[model samples]
Target: MTSVPRRTLNEAVTRFWSLAAPAYDFSALQRWAYRPPQDEVITLLRDHKCRRIVDVACGTGILADRIQRELKTEQVYGVDMSDGMLRQAMARSGDVQWLRAPAEKLPFDDGALDAVVTTSAFHFFDQAAALREFRRVLEPGGIAAVATLAPHQPPLLSRFIDSSRSLAHNPAPDEMRALFTDAGFEVADQHRVRRPLWTRMFTDRITVGVRSA
Candidate 1:
């Protein structure tokens, strides 16, 4: 996946989201697996005193809604590569600005945002590019809080999940922490958490990186 088929991949992603849009918020299992971690991640952002923020790859703006309602963040923007996803997001949270854009190319100016947050979408990103873009948009002392599936579990479980994963990579907590440090954010926190889907448990990581003040 070194040389990603950008156009082809983008089309596929868009098509997938478009189909998923109608029932995205209504799915019980999807909400169970993703929403719990989202609550914790939003708490992490607020604890860092993040004022202005962008939720990159913000699918349906669920986190954006929470950022506004919980953090009372002055300016919250949501960015995603798929228009269909953004459309659903815009509909759900009309006040927040929803942009259909890739994470590797954000619209914000250098050092323009106080914090950049993303969830469930990191592994699908071009890692270096996306991290660079994150660093580029963050202000000094800014934070980037990412919540995603962690590659940690029983060996057989990890192998099977990795094989079925659609993204380029699913990094362990250490790998993600180092990636943040390398991208100019000073690593502040990294830990694993779990969300349950009825009988199954899903492991995840919440990694926070802060730019030097």
Candidate 2:
């Protein structure tokens, strides 16, 4: 499939996060801003058997901390494009390895990871490029659990995001899944769970997939 224009998407993301960095922590506009439910999501990750997990687009290390607490893994790494966000994440949790990088380009060796998880940040990716990167870094049979809030559900969050002069765009699940398939992952499960309005903007669905051997 043809890819979206890189320069356009990069510029949009850069501007969006750059302006968002200062007030981002206090912004209720992010899909899920609360803490407890995020712990529940981490519990789900712990149930999986894989070790050596990588959290892509791991903004503020919400999921990373949970991984460190719940899972007995050899390594837990977090990667994001925004340095300011990474700084906040690093400050919050010093145990996990935080890297400043885009999801589309990972620095790890091929087939280095056992599992990959992301929460509420999939839509920002250039889907195809990010998935290809996931496929490249993930070992065969490695699982990827990606979570994103639905665009149609949360009116308040939607309104706030729409009002944000910097946020360029957001995509639906179908569009996101298509990119996953295009990158050669076989989707194994898709689940939707309702979260409190104060906790998150809308209900979140977690999609799990595996790279074929």
Q: What is the lDDT of residue 135 in candidate 1?
A: 89
| Whole-model alpha-carbon lDDT for candidate 2 | 0.72
How many angstroms is residue 103 displaced in model 1 relative to the true structure, after the best TM-score fit? 0.4
Q: What is the C-alpha local distance difference test score of each model? A: 0.79, 0.72
* lDDT of each residue in 1-213, candidate 2, tens digit only: 124467676666666675666676674644455343355557666666777888887877767867876785669999888776787888888789999888889879999998887876776676677888898999998887777666565666666443354242344667657767888799887766556656544566777788988
What is the clash tally of candidate 2? Answer: 0
Candidate 2: the clashing residue pairs are none
RMSD for all candidates, in order, please.
2.7, 3.6
lDDT against true structure, model 1: 0.79
Model 1 bad stretches (over 4 Å): 152-161, 194-200
Give the runs in model 2 whose Cα sits over 4 Å from its true position.
Answer: 1-4, 26-37, 159-171, 197-201
Residue-level lDDT of model 1, residues 1-213, one tens digit each, is 445576666667778877777777886845776787788778877778887899998888898988988887779999998777888888888778888888889999999998898888887787778888998998888888888777655565466445554434678777887788888889888876555556245677888888765
TM-score of each: 0.88, 0.80
CA shift of 101, model 1, Å? 0.6
Candidate 2 residue 23 Cα shift, in angstroms, is 3.9
